[model samples]
Target: MSSATVTTHTDDWVRHLLFDRGFLASMKGESIKVYLTMLTACGGEPDRSVTISLRSIQDATNLSCPTVIDSLNRLEELGLVVPTMRKSGRVKTYYIPGVPPEN
Candidate 1:
């Protein structure tokens, strides 16, 4: 017989997103995909912030530009993701909820 071990980090927000019936049920598939992609990009940083371009998100999720934009909007509306910075020609910074912004 063989045994396998698994390690996991405690991310209550992720748990809520995955197991909370009301919240999980309210999310669209594309929105979930985008959120997960952003989480991967952030990699559990303390601030949970990621500066990524729309093209990068599209490439990561294999979603169209418009679709990615819509998903971002949905995430923002749901208070799951917040845009920390936006510039005319620069990648936007998004912060996942549950972390206080550094001052």
Candidate 2:
């Protein structure tokens, strides 16, 4: 058996941001889903980042691989999320520009 202490603050602003088209908001279906999912995976900080896997995302949102990738790419282009490689060089660390990263 395995357990994880997930410290994500994903839903705090959902209600407020439901119609907020200025805060990295996306009008596209897949893009919105991806953005919401990323928020859900972030730490409780207002603009925190988290480590998300493609497989986990696919399971959580039921989005296809291509769609997920495309959505992430779109988000990146929009400067909403910043992706950096960890020391392991495998998993990526995604940071939201609105929040300062942990030191």
Candidate 2 residue spans exceeding 4 A from truth: 1-26, 86-90, 99-103
lDDT, candidate 2, 11-68, per-residue tens: 4354434445354444478888887778778743446768878877788889998988
Cα lDDT computed for each candidate against the true fold:
0.78, 0.68
**In candidate 2, residue 52 scores what lDDT?**
79
| Candidate 2 global Cα RMSD | 8.9
Expressed as tens digits, the lDDT of each residue in 1-103 for candidate 1 is 8998654553665675557535567679998889888888989533578899998999899999899999999988777789999867748999886632222
Each model's TM-score?
A: 0.78, 0.65
RMSD of candidate 1 to the truth, in angstroms, is 4.5
User: Considering only N, C-alpha and C atoms within 3 Å, which residue pairs clash in candidate 1?
Assistant: none
Clashes found in each candidate (C-alpha, N, C closer than 3 A) = 0, 0
